[model samples]
Target: GNNSGNLANISLDDILNERVKELYWEGFRRSDLIRYGKFTGDNYLWPFKGGVLSGQGVAAYRNLFPIPASDIIANSNLVQNPGYN
Candidate 1:
């Protein structure tokens, strides 16, 4: 029963924003952005796991992962995510 034919005007951003609203606190943003190629680039890098960072140096550009706040607080050797601190 759909008409108007305006559905094609919808963009990925529109879909993502809606999904973000629905899943905001459920911890799905990271996966969604990465799968959609919305994560990474000049402004975004996933956080490094503090345990890994403590065992290894701050990850190189190619090796980044999300570290929960608790992990960072537990490991003094671990560095916070670049932009977060």
Candidate 2:
């Protein structure tokens, strides 16, 4: 109930670990990791990142989803996101 005492001394890593346990399968992992600046770069790598067995950092632009090809073709003004093409 009263977690202030625990929160007072908890580190970012501790909070992240706890979040993973508490929010498993809730789809918050990507946002959480991005908020903590661990989504990209080699600082944090999960299983099979970039198709590598050991995992590896991905391009920074990978953070944003690419626009669909159909949408771009339909709308001349619709530009694809960076790093997609």
Candidate 3:
């Protein structure tokens, strides 16, 4: 069915909540949050977000996890993920 007519532009908060509801404890909790800017940043913080109950923004660079040193050392042709050299 073409349900697009019923859909509205969901807010980031709603998206975050939906992720938690649909994926909590399913192993993607952290990744989900990061994807939506909820894991880091004051946009949508949860417990201990920045070491405080109120939460804080993690380094934006952290969005792109660093490539392992071993891999970087082993493959000269490979480049590290963004935010890391």
Of the pair 2 and 3, which is ahead by lDDT? Answer: 2
What ranking of all candidate models by lDDT puts the best one first? 2, 3, 1
Candidates, ranked, TM-score: 2, 3, 1
Backbone N/Cα/C clashes per model:
1, 0, 1
Q: How high is each candidate's TM-score?
A: 0.43, 0.81, 0.62
Name the lDDT value of residue 82 in candidate 1.
60
Return the clash pairs for model 2, or none: none
| Clashes in predicted model 2 | 0
Total colliding residue pairs, candidate 1: 1
User: Which regions of candidate 2 are displaced past 4 Å?
Assistant: 1-8
lDDT agreement with native, every candidate:
0.62, 0.87, 0.75
Residue 67 of model 3 has an lDDT of 88
C-alpha RMSD between model 3 and the true structure: 5.2
Taking the tens digit of each residue's C-alpha lDDT, what string does model 1 give over 1-85?
A: 1486556577788888899899889998868866876565423333453334333233233234657789988997888766556
lDDT of 2 by residue, 1-85 (tens): 2555534466898889999999999989889988888888899888998789999998888788999999999999988898998
The prediction achieving the highest TM-score against the true structure is 2
Quote model 2's TM-score.
0.81
Runs of candidate 3 with Cα error greater than 4 angstroms are 1-11, 82-85
lDDT of 3 by residue, 1-85 (tens): 1466765567777767787788877888778777766666666666777788877777777777798999989999989887786
